[model samples]
Target: MQSLMRVVRSASALWPFYLAVVLFSSVVAGLGMAAPFIIREATDTIVDTVSYGTPAPTRTIVFLALALFAAEAASAVFSNVSGYLGDVMVARIRQILSTRYYAKLLALPQRYFDNQITGTIIARLDRSIANVTQFIQSFANSFLPMLLQVAAVLAVTTYYYWPLTILLLLLFPLYTWLTALTSRRWQKLERRKNAEIDAANGRFAEVIGQVKVTKSYVAEVRELDSFGTHYGETVALTRPQSRWWHSMDSVRGTAMTAIFLGIYLILFLRTLHGHLTIGEMVMLLQMVTMTRQPVHMMSWIVDSAQRAVAGSRDYFRVMDETVEPTANRELVAAIETTGAPELTVIQHSPLDAREPVIGFEHVTFEYSPGEPVLRDVTFRAREGEKIALVGESGGGKSTVVNLLLGLYPVEQGRLTVCGRDVADLGVEDLRASTGVVFQDSTLFSGTIRDNIAYGKPDATDEEIIEVAQRANAHDFILKFKDGYDTVIGERGVRLSGGQRQRIAVARAMLKDAPILVLDEATSALDTKAERAVQAGLDELMKNRTTIMIAHRLSTIADVDTIITLRDGRIDEVGSPAELASSGGIYSELLRLTASSSAADRARLKAFGFRVRDDEAKDS
Candidate 1:
């Protein structure tokens, strides 16, 4: 009923198969419930013939045997068909649950995805699915069939021997109430036990995933000790929960066995008193035999049902979540505004009137409630403008780029892309207009051609190759075992960092968006790769609004304008040459670097002084 609704709803889509299943169950129940009557008939007929040594009873027994065989065959067919349908239903539920989970995973906020543990997600997917699967296959297949059979047995017993039926009715309620009371505690304990198991699973997953790092740092003993400590806690928590569940089961079973003994005694006494015939006694005995299995099985199934019901509730919670980035459909005003006091500007080129590319109208944003990440930042990147954001480690450069990509919303100012505020443009439209190349080489497992074409799924072979060539990656790609068709391992792990970054650039080149965001794109590359990628970058930036977030100041010496940022505020913005000439923050950073380099050279010079001359060896 809970999270399992999705699986049920999905399974419901195959109602024809399930309806047949229900009908089959009904037939099986009918056959099973009638088996006792047939047994009783056979027993009484044999006993009557034996009492007088009567002849000519063979034909009657044959007819009864034939009827029983027919019922057995029909019931077997019903059972087989029901089983097939059960499998089909389970498969469908698994598929739907898996599909919806994947969709939900993608829809969750990026920040949320980054924070949640990988192991925890995996455990939820595995355990929740098992819960839904058990409910579908076990509950529907076993529980429903047993319930129908129980009803049939009760009816037949009550019709023939009303006294035993009356006894059963009285005793059944007593056990049911007791079982129900104990079951509540069992269910509560089950929830606690499952949570503890998942937590332990998460801890184990973390250790295994980072085992390489743990060993490299020589922290294996520490990790092992931590694991043992947490495992002990998990065991401690689980023991009580397990004890509670097992205690309930034990109590229910003892009470049920006592009740069954009483019923057997009453039936045997009634037979001796002649109040019940031999046939009725046999029938009642057979009914008891048939019903014992279900009663025992029901106790275990009840625990499963409680777990499934809870699991189903949790699964639906995720499916029903609307984490997609969309709000009211109202259009935001697009007027530009002035910057705050901390936002300094000098010799900054405004957005070209003809192009009207990207404009920041005093954008003020904060990752936290009080700490502003980007404070009233204002800038306009015109077409073909290669604007560089240079700042200290915590400066909000990356945040600004994320804002342009519409990954986050601007809190106090409007950001316009091609004259429409980013909020007004919609996420899909904004993404369509931008291509990003980040410092990390985000490559997928695929052939060179496949990876390149990911930027535009429908790109042709020639087109894909052309984009790779443009990004200076085509030559290296040709050296693979199968060239463009070669399968790169997952995340292109087999490739060098530089090669991966070049592939990323090729992907962006294939996209060819009007705006490009290069967040230290060359940082991961070696000097040779950097040189190769620089030429490609120059061409890629041609006629596009470029926003580059750079850490190394020397690399962006010729950047169109260096915006010196400090603590979410812009300290200065000017040409690299101008800023150097001005002796401001940029000049100070350059001087500091120059002094450090001189000291390094001086140290090296002293170390080499005695080693540089052949006269030292001659002396």
Candidate 2:
């Protein structure tokens, strides 16, 4: 309601439509009362007088009939004006919410997004906010119209007969009390139902997102059956929900029926006493019946309100979430100062960085509060280093990369990029220095050129092609019918794994950041593409400090340094040759790679390559 009112106040200039509503509502009420008067008068002049041997005036009755029609037409015109205003206000609200939602989305830090469900984040615009449009329309048009109609009926009915009007008025408090109690109960259930719906939406989206993996593992039916069970459970809760709603409706209907009969009984008694005309009694009955309609419409009102309230609660849940505060300092200054002692005077977090480049300084991090993922991670890749980070899965290697990029906060130490402390840097400032390519590279539906140039939105065809060539993505891109202009499906489903990886690399290359972190950049690539991309990555790494994460040992053999991470701690650190000779974790990893290479060669022997184990290792 506060949000709806805010929208109304923002569009206060449209209050004229509200005024028109009031004017027309009054016309409706006036006409509504006048029609009964015409009926009573016509009966008196014709039927009753005929029974008593008197005459009727046809002309006056016709004029009053026309007057009633005109009043109704006038009411419709005003209703339409109100509707137009409601639509206009709702349209404004849609624009306003969309702008605010997107702004908040872009402004929030990576941690918030990381913890949130992807489908939830994607669905925020529709789920809780969908009812906002209806709320604006109903609150303005229906709310006032209903209220005014009730008031008009009370006043008009009282003028004709105060006793009955007072009796009718007395029931309103009782009715409202029951509605309030019932609404309180149903709204709680509605809130729970909506929350569960969001949870289900998130879970369902997660399952579908990995449908390919599920298919490979043959878990498709099991996943779908689980979704079905969740749906059934969600439906089970609605039974109690419906019971409360029907209970309210039953109470309201029973009370109204008893009240209606009682009102008529009084009228019949009064008529028998010669205190009221038959026509007058009939008119009063019609008024009572008309009053029941809005009362009957109570269910609609409560249901709409309940849904709207639920939506508001959900939207506010996200909107009310707090983000990490950026400290008041220049982030780059703190980072540069650590390496160049003379430069350390100020401090800044990621939100306030001077460059997109990132640095890690004895930074340790953990997803859980006490279980550290990376321990005292200290590495510096000068601007443009072709760095590789290779370790077993969950070896804290990715954690180091994430911390260096400021995706996760350094729990025990500091991370600086472009010489500024990431903790104090502004988010945009931190982002300006780097582009990340993940093992599961993501691409959206767009032309190949657009996806490649996503990192640098203004990149020209020449620059995009150059980056693509460097990433070894140009040939595959040309395979599409439109080549650079061909649109890819969602997440680049039209492309193979190698193609996607290359494009992701090209994106990072085109971003042309001064620092690079390769977190399994070539995990899914063929050897041909891997070698080509390796060359590109080496060129990108030149003059830059890099931290790389590679799973395939052959990929990182020539890297500057290979640090073996065991659990959350470093187990070995040296060049691949040095570590291999030490007979440590790196040595084991290199031996495993050699074995795999031999197996690949034997598998390819049918092609008549006749490749030996040593020859394969050299290749």
Candidate 3:
């Protein structure tokens, strides 16, 4: 209830419209009560005229009919205006909620995203918010107006017969209690139904995202069978949901009928005893029949209310999540000191002259308690240096890069970027100093130019073209009829692996940040493609501190320094020649790659490492 009220209060900016709705609803309620009263008056006039053997009060009938028509006409105009204003109010509410929800998504920690799949997060955010909107609409169109109508009806009816009003007042609580009890069960079912629906959406999104793989393997029938099973579960749950809904409707209808009959019987008895006039009896009967409609509508109203409450709880759960640690005092101090735009590159020198451009000092970290992914790790990248981190999978190469990016806060020792403690620098400021390219690059659904210019949103056409040429993307981009304007489907699916990498490199190059990180950037491409994309990467790496992570040792052979990691610890650190002479972990890894390729074997021979076929073929 409080959540619903909070949503309502958020639209306080549109209070003028809300006030109009309330005023118009009151008028409609007044007009609704007038019709029954007018009928009672007409009936009384006719009864009196007949009893006295006098002429009918035709003038009085005509006047009452005119007043009823006038009331209805006025009510119609006000109701129309109220409905229009209600729509405007709800639209504004949706806009406010959507903006806040999206901002919250941006502020949330990356760990939150890592724990949830893209489809699941999208499903929950979209569905939960939609539920809130539906509730708001339902409340405006049905719930509030019905309450007003009920109050008006009761006030007029009670004025005519105080004793019967007392009886109704006694029964109203019973009706409310029954509806609340039934609605409690429905609320549980509603939550279950929403969960099933979100799960189905998540699965559908995941499968469709990999449709090419599914088709390649000829798993169409198998996928359909899996989806059909999920559909069956949804329908099964819906059946029980529908059953409960009907049960509530049944109870409401039967109870309403019984109450109406009891009210009528008492009214009929009182009329016989002359305690109630014939006209009063007729008015009470009409009002009792009118009460049935709102009473029937009550079941639906309660159900909507329950579903809204459940959804609001879920929506606010995400909204209430603690944001990333970038909200700390050190970040605030960094922001205040620079006074630079969030995305603007800072050119200031290091706080400490001895500190490297990027450094990790005894950094120990873990995603969960007591299961460290990195331990006693220390490394440095001097300005304009090209460093390579070569390691087996899960050897913490990416974690080190992630720490430098400030995606997660350091729980152990200190990490510095651009000679500033990452914990003390604003996240956007940290990001502003670096550009990155990953193995699986992400491109939004937009034109080629849009993807390339994403980092530098205000880049001129000439600048975009220059960077694209530097990254080797301009020539291929022009092959499409629309050139840079050509729409790249979601995640640049229209482009090949090499083409996507080039575009990603172009984007990073355009940013022109002083630090660059390339994480397995060419690992996904074929040899021909890798050679083509690597040229672009080389251009982007020039005059910047480059941090490269790759399983392919050949890719980093020319790097200034090579750091080999084993079991989350730095096992060896040296130049390619130095590590090769030492015959350490880096040397062994190079030999492993050389054993599989003639070209790599030739390169290894120059480094004085031999790959014996007997050793490679050993059981």
Candidate 4:
């Protein structure tokens, strides 16, 4: 009930449409009642004329027939108009609900998405919004009119005979009680079915997205079996649920038949004894028959209401999640009063060069309780310094970058970006101060120009071209048939790895942020592609405070400082040359890389790392 009321409140802005529908439906109901009365009066008049041998009142009979036709016509017209209004209301309500849900999704923190499947989240939104909208449309068009009809029928019948009214009224409570008995169990089954459907849809989406992997592994049969199992469970659940619902329906049907039989007997006996006229008996019978529809509709309404309640519950669960914290209101107001834009352009602040551009002081973080990924990790990068983090795959290199970007909060200590503590800085401000190039070079399905200008929407054509040139992507881009206008497929699948990486580089260059983060930017490329992309990276890193995470030690040979991590704790922090001889994690990794293969040795030698022949022989 609370969920239903919440949905009502969510749509309260469109109350005028609701009011119009009610008024129109009331007229329809009133017109529907008029037909029974006209028929009864006409029948009585005809009977009187025949019994007394009077002249047939032909004009009166014709007028009564026309009146009945007019009433039916008006009722049909009003019903259609109300239905149209209900459709319009439903469309407007859907717009409102969908907009709110999307906005909430945007405001939620990244952690909320980390544990959720992309397809499952989309499924939830689709199912919940669809059910809610369906219920609103049903209520406005079907349930409301039916309710008005039932009320009018009962009121008119009561005016003619109180005993019949009592019998008609008694049928409702008994019918409702039986439906209620089945409702709880039916809803339970519905919820289970919904879960199975959501899971199946989620997996289906995942499978489609990773079809290449499935095909490569020849696991299509396995995937099909899994998908089928979910739907099969839903079918299994429906068997018993359908039986329970129909059983209750049969009982309700039997009870309704018995009560109507009693009501019919009473009407017939009264008319026979001369207590009621034939016309009155016919009128009462028609009115009672009119209620059959609304009474039957009660079951459908209950079922729809249960689905709506479940949908709203799911929707509210997402709505109630805590949104990411925002900058202080007072601070925002102060900035607004000064007429400065909410998001300042990324440029160096007026802080002294001595202050760190990025700092993590005694920070600790964990994705789960009692298992820290970064512990007491402290580091800093001063203005115009290029710092590199080197470690094994799970040694918290990416977590450091994540913390600096405010993707996750620092739990034990402070993290500062641009000399302001991250806790006090707005997340948007912190992220806007840096440009990131990840390992995958994530790109959307759009034209090359769109991807390049994604970071700075207002960038001009010349600016985009300049960044592309700087990133060494201009020559290859022009090789395409459409140049910059060429539409790249999803994730830039149409582009080669080198082409995508260079495009990503150009995107970051166009942003022109003061700070840059390169997370294994060239780690996945072949040697030739790595050299090409590394050239772009070198150019992009110029004059910017850069933080790099590199598994390949040679990539950081020229960096001003190298910080090595061992088991989430900083093991060494020094210049590349210093770390090379520090005999710590960084040196060990260098020795390992140097002796991996002749190709690795050649690559490291080209990057100016010393590789003795003895180390190669030792391997």
State TM-scores per candidate.
0.86, 0.82, 0.89, 0.90
Candidate 4 lDDT over 161-227, as tens digits, reads 7888899998899998998899999989999999998899999999998798999999999999999
lDDT of 4: 0.84
Clashing pairs in 3: none
**Candidate 3 stretches greater than 4 Å from native:** 9-17, 49-59, 327-355, 596-619
Check candidate 1 and list the clashing pairs: 2-312, 2-313, 3-312, 3-313, 3-316, 4-312
By lDDT rank, best first, the candidates go 4, 3, 1, 2
Clash count per candidate: 6, 37, 0, 0
Q: Which runs of model 2 end up more than 4 angstroms from their true locations? A: 1-56, 113-116, 120-125, 135-143, 180-192, 267-283, 326-358, 570-574, 582-584, 595-616
lDDT of all the models against the reference?
0.72, 0.67, 0.77, 0.84
Worst 10 residues of 3 by lDDT: 333-342
TM-score of predicted structure 3: 0.89
Q: Model 1, poorest ten-residue lDDT window?
A: 331-340
Q: Give the per-residue lDDT digits (tens) of candidate 3, residues 290-373.
A: 666766676666666777788778877877787787853333332223121133343432233234888989999998898898
lDDT of 2 by residue, 44-66 (tens): 55666668865556687687677
